[model samples]
Target: MTAPLHHAGFFGFDVFGTVVDWRSGVARAARPFLQRYGIGVDPFAFADQWRALYQPAMEQVRTGARPWVRLDVLQRENLELLLARHGADVATLAEDELADLNRAWERLDPWPDAVAGLTRIRRRFPIGTVSNSHVAGMVQLARFGGLAWDAILGAEMAHDYKPQPQVYLKSADVAGVPPHRFVLVAAHNGDLRAARACGLRTVFVPRPLEHGPGQDTDLEAEDDWDLVAGDFLELADLLGCP
Candidate 1:
């Protein structure tokens, strides 16, 4: 198999589905809150419901319909919307409790291959998260998951969300790497497409289960990404990381 591209000085990752299992992570975190409210709905479906709003919520900011807002704020707003749509009343929950539940975005667990792959890749090049997640959230995730990120770069830095060229370019800038010298690894084709547009090399790592069993998109690389790997460890192996 062809080796993973190694010419880049740093690798910027799409953290949500690429490095961490957001479906499981969000679902798991929501379970306790649901149980406390005695809501019997599937937490997994609830997680999906919350995630379903992600792109559109960010699009508001991207389109300038809304001013720049952190991912956490967007998440909380969307959570309220989901609760209302589901007919679940969280009005009984204290404000801090509600906020803590929303901050569950910070505790997402990494994929099985994530820690090892990033650890190996870090030996050869600096690694950072270029996710649409907020900087504080990314920092919390790194600490919680032992991700070992050299820098946290994302929407918080760009003041915009992914698919926005500034987000990708801002990651490279924050990592102190030229756009051409940075590689972006993501499971979503749209993410890689944006990165590639900004002159960054791209690696597409398919997480077919990112949206859970019913997922249909991003199952394979839609474009000829620079590298396509089964997982981060495989990506590291292809990139010749020891």
Candidate 2:
């Protein structure tokens, strides 16, 4: 029989769409850069375009086509490609401007339920981020979004990205919990599937608008995840929290 989620020693959350509203945050941060280049593109579309490159970039490392690279570096490299692809004059920007723009991932705002829900869950279990972001980026994001994480676990720590068995196994080790004693809570089914394969418990929280309007994927649990909740607060309630 499946044990109650609260019985798990800790929960590792997926930060991007699960905790923080990355689309809004990235769009907001990218606006000034677009304006500076006289680019009249829809910022949200631009955000989506930038995000589309996320997995492909990580796959290079997962497949060993590239050395382990920090997510920040991949993000910056993707940003350059996105700007040029979207017709923004990348050459017009100063180096400092580019650097500041690349830090957008560090300033995302948390979802309304994130801080309070995590706070409540923390009373019963240790909570930390298991994200694809770099460790430094995750720390800055937590501080910026008021997320209280007990530890920051990410690609940088494992020197690899998620869906990789090593990343999930290493995260369990870092959380000081047996694989089965840990839960990976994410809005992405692929992520949950990978964790499940590694013997970790799974919870699916749907972030329907994670990709903005016309979003279709991850709207519901694809597999029989241990728990499926509408949001973090509901998840806390299902796990027997007050």
Candidate 3:
């Protein structure tokens, strides 16, 4: 026999593609690099490549091919890869400009419903971001977007990136909640699948624009999540108001 689910406890969540608009931030960062130091390179393509490279970079850590590198190193690795792909180099840019680009994740705009959804969740449950993003970046984003988090949980915190069970399970410990009492809200299906594997409850909300146009997500709600919503508002509806 099973017990009724507790509605009030703790929640683990994904922030990069979940609460914040990573694509918009990335695109904005690309334009400046393209305009200035991109050196006639296809920066739109670079941004696209940069975004695409995220998972594989984290996967390197997850699979033990690389050590527990933070998201900043992974982003830098992807940045250098994109530069190499175009036969360009980073030496052309001032150190300041290069460092600024690394801060893009810090400036991600929150989704329309993120503030409201998180605020609502906070009334009842402790909420934290379980993402591959660096701690400093997520902290700056919270300040940038006015997001309220009970705690910050990330690859930087756990020292293990996502798709790894250690990273996901650590969310509950970081937020001081039992694993079963927490829910992971994420936009990416792969992310949600990982949380589901950890015996953490899950809610999926679509970030259709996370990759901009022509991006096809696994829109099919998997059997894993306890709830699937088109966006954060619908998630709130399913979870009920605090």
Candidate 4:
């Protein structure tokens, strides 16, 4: 096994599927709203549909076609689209009800190994988020999942979304680490690729079930990442985290 890279200054993470189970978490949060509205769609499918809109929604901002906005705003917009697509009468829902449903993104539960693995890794190096989630949402999520982060550095800070060089570059800048000394750990290959392009080291941790049982994408590393771990625990072991 390769020894821990003590020279690395900071470890940044991609939160959604890498640190937390967004699909299951969103599905679980959507269940009550679905039940209340008598929406017969499977909650998981609803979650998937909402997520499907993520990239395009962000792309509008990434391309400067729309003003930069936090992820919460994008998620709320996506939720409305999801409700309309499923034929749910949005007019009947109260503002708080919609807000609560949208806040589902903030209440995600971490994967089984996430907390422990992070705890172990943090012992050796400072850790923070490099996710696209806004600051407020990331704080709530960390609180909900008992995630201990040393800093929150991502889209909100960069005013741009992932796969955008600014997000990775700005995050490393915020951490005061040179791009090459900063490591990005993510489950998605595209995210890793982007970080690598910006001179950040990459770690790919495959989450085969992130999209659910029928998921066929991001099941393995697509390129030669600096390291690949099956899960957080394995990642911790690879990093020689105590």
Q: What is the TM-score of each candidate against the true structure?
A: 0.95, 0.96, 0.91, 0.97
What C-alpha lDDT do the candidate models reach, one value each? Answer: 0.88, 0.90, 0.77, 0.92
State the lDDT at 168 in candidate 2.
88
lDDT minimum window of 10 residues, candidate 3: 1-10
**Model 4 agreement with the true structure over 81-139: per-residue lDDT tens digits:** 88988897788888899999899999898999999999999999999999999999999
What stretches of model 4 exceed 4 Å from their correct place? 1-4
| Candidate whose TM-score is highest | 4
| Candidate 3 segments whose C-alpha is farther than 4 A from its true place | 1-5, 41-44
Write candidate 2's Cα lDDT for 1-242 as tens digits.
Answer: 23657579889999999999999998998888788778778889989889999999999999999999999999999998988887766787788989998999999989899999999888778999999998889989989999999998867778899989889889899889999988999999999999999999999999998988899899999999999999999988887676
Per-model C-alpha RMSD:
1.6, 1.4, 2.5, 1.2
lDDT for 131 (candidate 4): 93
- Model 2 local distance difference test score: 0.90
Better of 3 and 4 by TM-score: 4
Task: Tell me the RMSD of model 1 versus the true structure.
Answer: 1.6
For model 2, where is the 10-residue window of minimal lDDT?
Answer: 1-10
Better of 2 and 4 by lDDT: 4
Return whichever of 1 and 4 wins on lDDT: 4
lDDT for 126 in candidate 3 is 69
In candidate 2, which residue pairs clash? none
